[model samples]
Target: MLVEFTALHWIYVVFIVLIIGFMVKRWDTSLISILGIFVLAIVATGDLTAALSKVFNSFIYAITELLSTILIISLIVAMSQVMKKSGINEVMVAPFTKLIRTPTLAYWVTGILMMIISWFFWPSPAVALLGAVLLPVAIRAGLPALGVAMAMNLFGHGIALSGDFIIQGAPKLTADAAGIPVADVVSASVPLVIVMGVVTTITAFIFLRRDMKKGTLELVGTYDGEKVEEKSENLLTLGQKKFFALLIVVAFLLDVLAMSLLKLTGGDATALVGGTAVFILLLLAVVAHKKKGLEKTTSYFIEGFQFGFKVFGPVIPIAAFFYLGDSGFIKIIGEYLPSTSQGIVNDLGLGLAALVPLTKEIAVVTLAGVGAITGLDGSGFSGITLAGSIANLFGTAIGEGTATLTALGQIAAIWVGGGTLVPWALIPAAAICNVSPFELARRNLVPVVVGLVVTTIVAMFLI
Candidate 1:
């Protein structure tokens, strides 16, 4: 059966296809393609006023919904900067270096550290910390900087950010679109995340082993100035080390307490992290620049915001176009698209469901593949809106048992696009390690591809 395409549907398909082409070719900025979609939507509706309204309203609505989360991310970044300036970040990772004596151990250690920190603070801040501290250690331990980057990308961006069990941002986004509780999405994501994590990590290890065998392994700092030499004397004063250690321990405990007492999840959890970061920043800044006072504190915050925007800004417009596909966002776009009971992505998915033979196994693979492909645009969470809509539509068309299939698709899409497979997503990590983003992406290719394959298989049997 051929799916019937409405004018609106045709517009969206063209927009999505063109965007995908732009990404594959690296022709122009994604922002240009996104703007083109906005123009196309307006032209389709044939209303200048409506298009103008959508331009302003849609951006406002999208920003407002995400404002708190964004602010929190900025704050946490700022705190990381403070920690770096204070030498606390180095102190934090120094102990771990002793355990990561070899290249292979470096990969696993970096992955584990990324996963733990990302679960609490989100991957963005986690990347900064890892890059600044653990990266040098891994490099010194005979791990390639590119390899260190891949490990961080897979564990932090792919595994931790994808499941978002602690912060709940990813699941919350999917659940909101699915019309289900955030807790339900979180519960469903746990097993899928574990499976993906194990597969991706093991695949990465295999590659690391081959590199080791070839004697191609180089210390991470060979290309950069990040090598850590073992000093006979501790560089930091004993009092300073003790104070920072207590500070780190207290901060971690506060995060746990906040998560437990406030029951914060998703955006709220991000806020908690960000708030704690600010508190830490203030505490550290005051100690470091007591004479400079509030002016220095202000500068630290500005620096943090700069980092946050640098990391997240490029994806905003891309997110805006996808937001147009949702019903909640259609009104923001104004009368350009008529209000229908169905979301654009949902309508399209339902149409496909009618034609496709969505058995249990087929459903899982199909959804996961579609999710991963949609994420090719490089904004991982942006695809969840599409995945959720598709899941709901196709789940109904196939069987009630397909909810997990939908969730699986959501997970795969974000995990891959969010930063794992995309060069753009790994920019901070690459920049910090002074490695090439494209090469880092190449390093991640096999592991992420194998992981996705394994994840789909696991989802089929488990879900």
Candidate 2:
């Protein structure tokens, strides 16, 4: 497939590089991201007034995409605030403290559990369900809060989401695009996913341990590191605390059962969890506070919203810029591209695939590279069709390894954009752990890159 390259495409490519460079340097990319949106709008619409409007419209679009995640995180936090005040959170995590006695056990146990839950419920709800309960336990076990975030992120968002074995969403998308059965892609992906997961997770653990030993791990703004004032009065008695704790657990377990029985996934699954959190928050607040229940519910919500927005504020501009790379351009700047355009991101991916040589080795490297490139937009699913199409083309030319190539591309795309290396995409874990998303992204960079490299080499052999 021949894809037309336009000025709009070039402008987007340049800004993507600039944004990534800024992030690598730990510099705020909000200004550059906003500028990128304005420039893209001005060039596309050729109307200064329309361009100005797009700047604001882009932010709205970004927020809309992120609102579900924001709501779930806030609700979980609100429920947690009451749990903490009532001593329910402590009670809930007490059992885990026995199992997670050391930092090593905490990291692996939390990560493994997150990966399992994410495979079923997906990472957004998994983060919410586990973070509140396990974060405190992990921290108390001597792991830094950021370490816990990385563990959840790498396992839940990176490993489980990339493979998507149970949900099969990722494999289905790529397989359909490749004109193959989903099972073929899933079968080929198992080895690749295992290789990538084990290598990346082990590398991360080694680095985390090294940093801990050197006393160089950062703890800024984390739950363990921050100094939060505690309420002097215990709102709930031991019986009440234990009751609410058990109720919380049973409610989430029912959510799991409902998800399995009703075949709920993604947003529906997240909504179920968020709604349950709200109910728990209200019940705990009213029962604990008595006459002040109404006031306290609102207060807890306010606190939760404050935390949510603060964590998400820096992310909005960056997400806005990237959204334009996919579907947001038409919405924010009007339908200004040529009719042949497959949005800027897909067009770029196709153009890159067209340029690469079709040798087996080059095919392996190009698939991984193209997968990572498509992931730059931060919606891991958005550009995967391009990866699948490219895999089909390369597989035909090489006369083999179509399934393996497609699987490799899917894994690379999701690991990079699904929430491991991308700052905004991984914000749920960061926000829940009270760590900086950029720092989490930075910490993930080396391990993920190494894993991709090794996985790419393994793909070369498989091909």
Candidate 3:
């Protein structure tokens, strides 16, 4: 079937072109692109009277709908920040240093830590903590900073963030788009995640081993060759340290209890995590700076919000563009299509499906490859909605494991875009480690690509 373009469709195309061009040229802010799209949509529909209303209405709606997930992310980030200032971040990774005495162990430990914390917190915050604490240890153990970053990126942002099992952020988005239950997506993703994780980590290890043999390791320290200052220790008082430790333990225990007792799933679980973070933040601010009064308390929260926005702001417009592909948000454009109409990305996928005479094996590989290529634009999660919809369309025609195949696509997309192929996403980690982002991307290319290929093959057979 030929896809017809209405005025709204033309507006979307124009918006995408403008956004992509701006991103490629590094000429426009994400906020500008997002507002541009909204404005264009309103103008296309010739609804100036409603345009003003939509400015506030659309943002409010989106924010409200995503409030639970965003709050959870913000709280987790704030908690990690608190831990960093209190020295718990150092303490948390201190024991791991002993265990990761060798380059091989360093790679595994970095990957594992990134995965665990990224699952609960996020890769952005996890990168800061991991780079501050674990990077030095890994580098001193003869691991390259490049290798350390690769491990963190592939495991934390690529695999863990893509799966988002603990927080359910990525899976929730994919599930919502596919009109599938979040539990179903999460369950189906387990095997796919295992395949990708094993393949990616092993490939990264191979690269690390090769680098180690070459004796190209660089350690993180001051100019005089001493370990970096123990910034964390000097930042907190003794009482503050004790209080944060107790608070962390209580927060974690409460999380476990909430998950167990309430049987919270998806957004509910995310809200529980966020709520706990807020409670801890409040407690810490009160106990630590009680003498400063309410002004200090407000300042801490403002700091938290600033941190959250800094990390997550760039993602909003990117996400908004992808949201255009979702059925729920399409109505906002005010152009109704037939019930049989497919979103633009879905239409593109179906077109590919038609042209490619793919067997089950070929289908899985093709899907993975396509997803990875799409992710090259530098937003990992951006491709999932497209990939998920396509996977459902194509996988259903082939056999019984559609969800698993869909998940394979999701993994490839995230592993590539999350940080491995893109310098933009690697900025935080690279800056913290004092490494070159472009070089980090170069080092990640081979291992991550090889891993995605192997994982796709494994998933083809298993799924």
Candidate 4:
């Protein structure tokens, strides 16, 4: 076996299956996640004390990795609370109401806007930019909070991110590893991206509409399982509301412009949006609560932080367990993985690639499977290199379609891990809409799986 396939690797694989089982059954995976970490530590180190401590250490690693996302959600929620109370959210969404009058329109409009902005700025910052503005409008138009979350997730993270046409970040990683041109990967990915995007979005929409008509889905709009209480009386006058609303719009627009001109993406772009939100929150807090401004600002932050941590509590353990599959093993546990091992996840991907025969049908299937396995770490980008390497091996043997195979792998990795099906990965959309991340993941499960299956079959012909 490659990389000395040991008990530790088997342990990790077993727990992954168990965790997935828990998630599919709608059971809490926190216990299983923590148990997995402890067992892995014990098997790796043979120290009970160390095993116990690794559990705590893994959570620290998960939170450290997740803190930026937490902060962004906290800031956005704080700003949203103030805006909602001052009634500026109403004014901000008024123009959108004209364009999105029904649930179907709300789903498509929000999804399309999310896709366009995500292509430019990427999904994290795009979620921050769009969620506060469009979520309210969508809800008012009869789309459930979960439905709005689905739209943002599928279009932004699944479509825009998988194709990554403008940023070209995804294709660059895969193409380099596969020894192909970046343009080839991008060009090849277009049809696969379209197929996945269309299938997932339409399936999600149809399910959402069906649930709504059946009255099986809850209609309440919440941000952390709590209903937003609208202010009985508007603190801002008509003119004030309009002025503040436009000011917010202009401020975010300027941020978007700055993102393009300064070439800020990912963390830098997210920081810009976060800073803008803090300022907006302060302005609204002071205006709405005047003499009580200072106290009110503190209270709003408390509210936001409370929601952030509350939402993340269940996620930390599962994220920690997944992290161990990557570089996190060295950090959270120890450097016990053999020197030749390319981390557990990557090694497993390579192992699977080694086992599969190099025919186009098996090549495409194995690439998708390998991509998905690597993506279990939840950083979709972390594993595309492995996907690309496998694509190269299969392509070399098959004597053709390297780019198409690589593109298919990239699509599968991203759609599974970038944010659609993974609970923690897609939490931004879930947090912004105030829906449960796990529930959002569940809602996304069928659509994403169907899309991946259909896209995989389509790639057979493309190859």
Which model scores highest in TM-score?
1
lDDT for every model?
Answer: 0.70, 0.80, 0.68, 0.79
What's the TM for model 2?
Answer: 0.66
Clashing pairs in 4: 223-434
| Colliding pairs, model 1 | 139-220, 167-266
Stretches of candidate 4 off by over 4 Å are: 100-232, 358-463
Q: Model 1, residue 278: displacement in angstroms?
A: 2.4
Which 10 consecutive positions of candidate 2 have the poorest summed lDDT?
Answer: 223-232
Q: What ordering of candidates by lDDT runs from best to worst?
A: 2, 4, 1, 3
Higher-ranked by lDDT: 1 or 3: 1
lDDT per residue (tens digit) for residues 326-395 in model 2: 6667877888888998767667656665666457899899889878876765666655655776687677
Candidate 1 segments whose C-alpha is farther than 4 A from its true place: 1-6, 27-46, 139-146, 176-180, 220-238, 333-340, 349-351, 354-357, 378-384, 399-407, 434-436
Please give the lDDT score at residue 105 for candidate 1.
90
Candidate 3, residue 351: lDDT:
52
Query: In candidate 4, what are the lDDT values of residues 1-463, reduced to their tens digit?
Result: 4547788889988986786566445566779889999999999999999999999999898788667666766777777767767777567556766898899999999998889767644676567667877887788889888899899999999999899765466776677566677778988999999999999999999999999999887664454554333442468898999999899878878987887899765457667888998999999899888999999999999988887676557667776777777677998898998889867765765665576555789889988887776566565665666577667657766768889989998998889878988787877787778888889989999999999999999999998
User: Which stretches of candidate 3 lie above 4 Å from their native place?
Assistant: 1-60, 219-230, 233-243, 246-250, 260-262, 293-296, 311-314, 321-326, 329-331, 339-363, 392-402, 461-463
